[model samples]
Target: MSADALTFDCIVVGSGHAGSCAALAARDSGCERVLIVEKSPPEWVGGNGYFTAGAHRTVHGGLQDLLPIVKNVTPEIAANIDLAPYTADEFTRDVMRLGDGRSHPDVVKALVDGSRDAVQWLAERVHVPFIFSFNRQAYLVNGRQVFWGGLALSVEGGGKGMIAADRAALAAAGVETWFSTAAIELVIDGDRVVGLQVSREGESITLRSRAVILACGGFEASKDLRAQYLGPDWQRAKVRGTPYNTGDGLALAQRIGARLTGDFAGCHSTCWDANAPDDRGDRVLSNQFTKSGYPLGLMLNAKGERFVDEGEDFRNYTYAKFGREIMSQPGGFAFQVWDSTTIPWLRKEEYADDVVERIWGDTIEELAAKLVEKGLEDKDAFVQTIRKYNEAVRAFQAERPEAEWDPAVKDGVSTQSSHLQLSLPKSNWALPVEQSPFLAVKVTCGITFTFGGLAIDPDTAGVLSDATGKPIPGLFCTGELVGGLFYRNYPGGSGLTGGTVFGRKAGREAAKLSGAAR
Candidate 1:
């Protein structure tokens, strides 16, 4: 290996959002020599980051507070938008609530505390094109765009745009990145990680460094890992991100006795198009394959039964766990049925004719008949299910005439009443699927990232050692590789914000350690 290759103060293993944030933060924190090694080729530079929707959840005082950072909102538009302030306490509660209170308090607190600052840093330093998520998170209510969910901001062109800005920022910071460099092992001297042994173009080279941060992501793409950790059904699940995240960081850390933490059996999965590729994400279409329109409609399994309450909560709160539900259904797939009333409201980016295959039927029975060809086992059961659901909706509407259908808030338009009720109720926004020209889209589970990863110190983002129950010297971790913040389910957009927050911390800490070593 060249002498220059062995001289980096900090070597980051990955080039995703977290790695980029780490490299940039290292340079800013006074690390003179920083390097990022990517396992994928130059074309696949941003790892799983390139496949994200770029939704960033952060603490802010409603629309006014975010106005300064976002580029999409205008004076006229801002006046017609309704967005409530998202407090740190609220964000903290959401993370814990969705995680079934299993999330590590320290990790959750660190993420919540650093969220706003991390977002601002990204906007200012990395020049990420921030915009109000009008198309995805808001709904038209009484001539105003009401942002229902806690999330409200996203990048201009989503993941692709964010990655472009991150790459540019890395270049401006003079951080060198070596593509197609796979981290084979972590080189340790005593208790400190001194360097990395990597394979570049079939040649193994040892590159020395003062500190190393593993942000290479989780084992979502490995079918074997999925079967071993996330259950056998997950082996058939489609990967929603980069195929390169096969637990290399976890494997390297395990070799050195890094403590394993978080939910090994849980992951951030989503309802994706049934036709989407199984092994990897589509770079061109990216996250558009996501099928989150179920909140506005009905999701029926092959048994022609509503397994989950379609409107238990906003899409942001419930989309992540619904994928696991879909995986458990017969044939490991479900159909999202929406009438003309809600069809137009479905995000065009996701439900557009060119994006996903859509099946149309003039009547409920016809839709059921068409769905039988896909995977519906009982056509008669399917037809009866919709009829019963429609009756429940009618009965509820008759009892509570004042209960209006509002998607912006959890409008109590439910299918359950004291007089007449179904076994499983559509809790909110339960408009009957009776409108003509109904639409149904086939969907399957798409695993995003695994929740099982290395344990770390929330303050310094240092990987914790299993032997001593302390921070591993000269080693740090961030991104999806550092877990203990999520379990069972994940709140939408928190992943990106958490990555940035901990990535920034890891970078600064690693840089400090590097200086001390020098």
Candidate 2:
């Protein structure tokens, strides 16, 4: 290769949330030339960030504490916004509790400490609107303040509009973007990364750089990797987002001796269709049944028996209900049955007409017949189960006021009802499968992202090699590529929070390295 083949101050791989932030931060920090290499086209900008519900949380005092230290936010604006402050201790406790003590303390601390600034930086600098409320769930500001609607807008333009805004900012900053270019490997010179070998339009080229950032995302969409790392159960589950994430970056990094951490793979189980086609051609509505607190009139496994507390944590419940726990039974999965009353509620409140349509029946027998027609269940058995459940619901309602009856009668944390008035009629039970046209849909767990990835230092955002227990020089990894930070469980909106905070850190640090080289 010629000496002038290609060169840049910094090279960032991938154009997801992390890579976008990294590129922007580097340029803003005065790096003269930064290049972003993306295997996919620009139409795929923001990666999963475009599909997110955009809530951000931090463990530190809200925007107030961060405004003074962060360059992006002004004291006047910070003071004007209603700020919610959460102590580091409380944040730590919540994270640890949610993670089941498996997450790295340092990573959690870095995310929590830097979160306020990250949120402010994106809002103030990128022109992304940040609200305090949306759809009833409060935004956990600074890990303390429960603000409404303070999340990035879904690409559909739900609210927080940072995904598009950030992309625009990166372009305005003159960050060179090479789409349809895949980074095949890290160009290593001794222990340091020199740059990347890229393939674009069938041409292989080498790009030289002083610093490199890996933000290529995780392996949730790769069936082979999911089966290998996440176990057989994952192989059979449905996937929620983009199907292109095959863990190419993670595999490449490992080949170069990067250590992996967190679990082999962790997934959210709730709101997934247990038997929805793996091709994901069918639109599965999760918000309706999972987030809207809908009642499960009857939950039956393949053998037609109730197996779990329907109202438990939707993510966890889905996993347990779909995995070997329920699949090992006579039926490979479970079917959720509800009535006409439930369908309208799901449609009006949950915006889940898709789900309602899939399972709707005008009569209990018709619904059971439909499932049989779809090859989703045994017609006779499903009908019998509905009859039994209806009898039980009627008995329960006869004894107690409709308002007093809980759909998730057995529950540790009862999410049985969000709109309490809706649960008052015993007939409102996702029960009485008697309401002629019953609804039944075979459901399975669907995963959003895999948690396992390269281990990194929270302070530097540097990818650490297992052999040396130290960061690999010139190589910084962020987003889903870096793991052991989230533990096995997620803390509400922490996924996006970590990505933004660490992406900024990596970009800034990479810029500093580039400056030194010059």
Candidate 3:
């Protein structure tokens, strides 16, 4: 094809949620010809966004305020739901707290302020099937579905549904997309980006464009990059998303003097099923491989010791960092143990018999013995750990008989009290593992996305030049490639919302750049 045929007003790299949103926004903003180029083949399309749970964190006035946008919540169902308002301040605090206060204030403010409008645009414009996250974010308590962790919405079919909706929107908006097109470098015109050089059909081709947006994602899937940036332990971490995100956007932008920022040594990792594929995510099972029930039970390392306070906070807030803790353990794996009391409450999507390998025992001793074959180095240590944990639970229960175990809220049902306290306390929902038919599931670290990425202007999502410390004209970024929003850890559900918010801004700015250049 001729170079003129490949020319576009704006070109977005990556066909994931962020890129799709950018392309659609460019078209809506009056860009005559917008294009998206994805490195992965047609089969591996959506990048890391396809493996997400599709949860989106946004500010709202509670259940009533969200019901109008969600398709799953009928009037009758909404009546039985109790969803507290998630304010902008609360959302901002969650990101800052999880990021250890290293998150850029301006970037975080833009994310928090734009989240609601971005979600609404996704629902109304992109036709993403938004639904109340009943299974993943809510718990049944006294016949009422109480939502916690400031997260209440998800796509209908999780990540798969989200990608489908985005594809449809892109096609409807007349945005052209090309798969198996790997961007090699940003075509630099003096200090500004003018186009992209890409590899297609094993041939290097230069595609001209007035502006470019990088949304191809982070370096979590590259073992070399992970080992180099996040440490050697990260080399063994299983990829929870596409294997295609090997820092292409970061490399491409850095070649043009783009500044790199954010947490290079940190990432969003999670407890994943040990038996799941290590290189790529399973499209059919997708996010179901996550083993997030550790908060509802106990996580013991191979040494049969509790490393973290399992109930330090809600599962949404703590799951990301716990994977790093598990990776630092012997064999880079851990087991989650739950008795009949909470096993029934485990998310069926994650713990179903067909989803993960399960080991069952009538007693704690037998359970520990069974785990010996599955990498538990010391059987006796495992049994003793549970015994001590149960004793602490019982002691706390005796001291606070008035405190009931409510998974829906922080009820102060803890393992530490005036009577006795364990060294590592389950600070909330402390339940004893004394029930018969105990279950155990092995888990390993699943790397979601890397925290290190390109630095961008908070308002326009324009990539900043490392040399000038200013916006690089005609260069923009979004998705996991745009950084400084997170530091050491991440608040659950913020990724998708942040990606869309910045993607919209990037697209509008890029469209204006394209018009001015013409």
Candidate 4:
């Protein structure tokens, strides 16, 4: 790298939610010249953020507090809804428990503490219009929509709109972004990062900058990396996001000896449509590839046996891990079986015809025969499993006539097997697949992002040196590259918000060092 290379105050890699936030925050923090380098063309510059449905898990002070941010909530709507506070303590506890205490406490604390303000902070800079998540976060009760879980609002029009908002803000802020430019290496000299080496349209270029924020993504899209870090057969897993997220930032950071953290093999996997393409689906038809109605049904492996306790917890907490369990099954797939009783109330994502593969039958034998025709399993085994499950549900129904079946919260509805021979038992909200028009939707394991990356100072979002565990000058990281915020598992909708929290922090802190020119 030459000493006379062109320099800027700050350079942000990638154009996803994190990168967009970082670039904006740097400019806001008084960085005179800010640049964002994205490997993808401008059309696909948003990375995985564009593929998401804009669900954000933030600690809120109930519906009353949410009225200001959520622009579409009418007075009538607010009056009919019931919501409670989601304090920082509750958010922190969930983060700790969500990862089984494997998550770094400092990072989790930052995420929880910065969450509520972070959403507002990003929205003000990007003009993101927030709206209530009526489909997945709410259930109809007494002619009113009641929101559950810790999630409340999402960016209007989902992730695509979010990207558009950020793009406009970037233009308004006079920030420059270079498309089709891939950062290959960090320009390190005497333990100080000075610039970046990038290849733009196959032409090499050296650009010097006081700070670099690496926020591209993780290794979920790389077959070789997935096999190496996540073990064998992981390459067969479907990608739920952008194919361009092939760990460019993680590789660049590792080249500089950034200390890695979090569970390397862990990821945010989910039950996705088995017939979906290997890469992500169309941005216009996003959220169609994810099928999340498993809580209302039974998931059987290839051998026609239930493999997990679907009702062990709410879908928000359990779906992230169940997808990984499905990959561990006999054929790397699972079938979500339901009946007419539970089908009508199923999540709207299940009805996306282009992305989902569904089967139906009026009788258990007919359903099993249909599955056998697909080369799945023997008809006898499927019938026996269904019969045993039906018996248990009926027994429970007879014993507990007062049980209230609620979907928003964990209702006490469950099954009771008198035989006690069932290998996998449903813990809560269990209903038998005995009604006419039995339905089954096939789904495979789909990974979102890996939970491993370099460790960073949670306060400043600076990448820590592996040799001394000290902050590396001019090296900051956000998005998926800053690990220890997530570990074995994660809560749904936290990924994007986590990126916002650290991205803004990284941009501000990185900009603070921009005054120290070489």
Candidate 5:
């Protein structure tokens, strides 16, 4: 290595939540110099972490126990909200159940066990303020705020704020960061990775490093990769975050005999606004570009047919997978239908911007007619579907005798029909859409980060060699690059937690490897 050329004790690729955290951990782990290389320009430094709400789904003993972490919560406010204890076992069950027990147990355990600590560690280093997520993760129950779905705290400024806080932490730790610089290849020295080839503004250079941590994201933004792994139709799906996440790290690692893990086709997706630009929407819009209110309403395809069961489970539990289902529907599009009765409780997305495409009407017939004018294939089919659903809702209410609308819990306010039974019945939070004026929002699939990535040594967060069946010395990874933690689905808010959990582990171990290399 040239004496004047840049070098680091540990070099981290990507400046997302995982990469930033890894840099901080490397410094804390006694590494003399840690450098973070971000492919994105300085403006878009945080990857998907900047696009998220920054809500963390972690285990906690409830509001009382979280008082220390969320110091802003007053005692008076605490009495109204019920923050139930989400134990480690519950975290494990959520992960296994969501993944259908397909997620690697070791990876899940590492995430669950280190979750709380991860939040605390980030908090101490970054000076970020965390608070209860009032809008989505909790509901007002019997005049008390009852938190459910195992999601509790969030960074005060959401993802944007959290990213800023992480950047602050990086600067404070004296870590070097390179924005708009991309790592082209991993410089493998025989059996160990010893340096990295990077390019910036058409200039190329190689930087030597004792150890490397790859925290750049997956292939969600690559249309070709999406078609290759997630199917052809996925290429049209709107990207929920940075377009820079085109599987650069994954592609580089694969060249070095890394074994990829999890479902390459499976990704975290949601109901994005149909009118949203093809690329990731601006960071200023942030979490507002998508609609998460489908649970409180119904979704219909171009045929105006109810495709997936809108009330199958809590929105967060099923929203990601359901986006893929929508993409599979005819025209690769769907519309969300709701009425005044459901509008009050829906997650806020209706008021996003003038670009929102929705048809509003005072009556079902009018709504159907308006939808037809907006290019719906079959208005008659929509009318029949609505009538059948409304009839089922009444039947369910009469059958239960004491059914009431409760958002805090899966209130079992469902629908059933004998005359016109739905192939996919609504399971919970089902209310008749009889109230007016009715509304329908056009929606399509918006994919977030992908699940496929390099296999890892769960304990050390070191990338394991597919051929050797052991960790590749001097190589570690975290965030979306570290796979085997998820399969079919993932727990909401667990992405940040997973990054923190493994990022710390990778950083510590990489620092140790740097020492050994010396």
Candidate 6:
């Protein structure tokens, strides 16, 4: 391939979940020459999708409830996939609750409507076994097959099996896979996306296509971009994933007049050890809050003062606390403190290996020492803080009877309180940190995705021009690129679900346009 020229019916840039699905959808829809250009080699699965917890949301009830077509979805798929029974009104209300009045109603509705079909379609291609966990109200599909193998397989099938099946299916459909190829630019003709300029092993190639899909991902890895978008406060965030997602596609699209949506970015909150070095020496950890339950203890800055409500949605609170609050603090970091009772629960309950290690200290004193050793806190200040906290806890408990004692713990209970102590001790209240051998772990908030991206029409998933309020010709977007669609609040797991739902729409539409052109 040379930088001079190549041609295809459609070009999909980035091989993450969205790009892969778009590529497959184009080929499956009868485009003869579809190409998937991936920057990473085949061996390296894209980090974001691969490491995700794989939660998805779909609406249920309303007029669709009476449609036979909707009802006809297999029991297995329905059972595995939760239908939240959201009426259009209810759905809109829920989105609005999170979106804070900024969401595009049409796009929100489209996603709610399309999720069922998307799940069914993806399930049909992959052997997704539905598990009835978390009660009958919720459903769980085996995403590991999709994540590991790229296809659905029997219980015995591993990641290799799924990947082979997915690759084979694409190959059989004649979707060209160009691993180790990087898309450097979007070839634009006026306001329309015409092709892509790509590079591989020092070679540059221009692949012309009727449509280009910019699914390259957000700027989670770019420190400069993070500082610019998330404000100067983000200078302390730890980059948790791959270094490759530097917003190349986003930059190219913006340069070509693509409109941005939402604010600079969004983030997830959870416990991560600041001490552990990632493969790149970037100090960070994973976002696996569900497994850990919640950090039931108090979190404080270097000054050893309680900040945000520790019991807030462990996930969302992490974002609000670390991303917005703590990151802006004097030191740009914070520490989590808990008693001996909390350590065992944290170790057993939290899934992140880093968090478990951070649950050190037999007493509040030991915990303070550990934090000081980690260079997260000053020894004298931390010790004084704990002494004050212990005094507060004792005073609070004295004010209440033992029979009336309640740890006032929310989110999760410390192991000592739950396992060692039979009941909540008013003595353990989160007032002052006067406990002995306390445990503290340093943590920094890092970004996950840019909430702001190319603005698109909610109804059609087509990129919108800010000036004209019209769709960009021959262009469509999904995932993080569709902005204002989720302006203020996010429906749980809507990000990935939106990607699947709208990526399918974009692919099908692009394929239709390509076929019509032919």
Error of 5 at 219 (Å): 0.3
The candidate 2 region of ten consecutive residues with least summed lDDT is 151-160
Candidate 2 residue 366 Cα shift, in angstroms, is 3.9
Report, for every candidate in turn, its global Cα lDDT versus the true structure. Answer: 0.92, 0.63, 0.92, 0.84, 0.85, 0.56
TM-score of each: 0.99, 0.77, 0.99, 0.96, 0.97, 0.74
Q: Which of 1 and 5 is the better model by TM-score?
A: 1
Instruction: Provide the lDDT at 323 for model 6.
Output: 46
Per-residue CA lDDT of model 2 for 254-294, tens digit only, reads 87899988866575444455444463322223233332233
Taking the tens digit of each residue's C-alpha lDDT, what string does model 3 give over 328-425?
99999999999999999999999999999999999999999999999999999999999998998998888888989999898778889897899888
Name the candidate that leads on lDDT: 1
Off by over 4 Å in 1: 516-518
RMSD of each: 1.2, 7.0, 1.1, 2.2, 1.8, 7.9
Q: Candidate 3 versus the native: TM-score? A: 0.99
Rank ordering of all candidates by lDDT, starting from the highest: 1, 3, 5, 4, 2, 6
Scored by lDDT, model 1 comes in at: 0.92
lDDT of 4 by residue, 1-518 (tens): 45543688889998989888998888998888888999888878788888787888899888887788877788988888877788988888777888888889899988888888888886676788788888878888788887777777787878888888888999999999899898999998889998999998888998898799998999998989999999898989998888888989888988888888888889988998888788665666666678888888898888888888888887888778888999999889988888999889887665644556678888878888788755567678778887888888778777778887787777767775454435667888888788899988888998888999989999999999899899899999888888888877887788888989999998898778986322
Name model 6 segments beyond 4 Å from true.
1-5, 60-95, 128-173, 265-271, 276-295, 314-321, 340-356, 376-439, 487-491, 516-518
For candidate 5, give the lDDT of residue 494. 90
Model 1 over residues 162-278: C-alpha lDDT tens digits?
999999999999999999999999999999899999999899989888789999999999999999998898999999989999999999999999999999999999899999999
RMSD of 1: 1.2
lDDT of 5 by residue, 471-509 (tens): 888888999987888877888899998999999998898
Q: Give the worst 10-residue stretch by lDDT in candidate 5.
A: 346-355
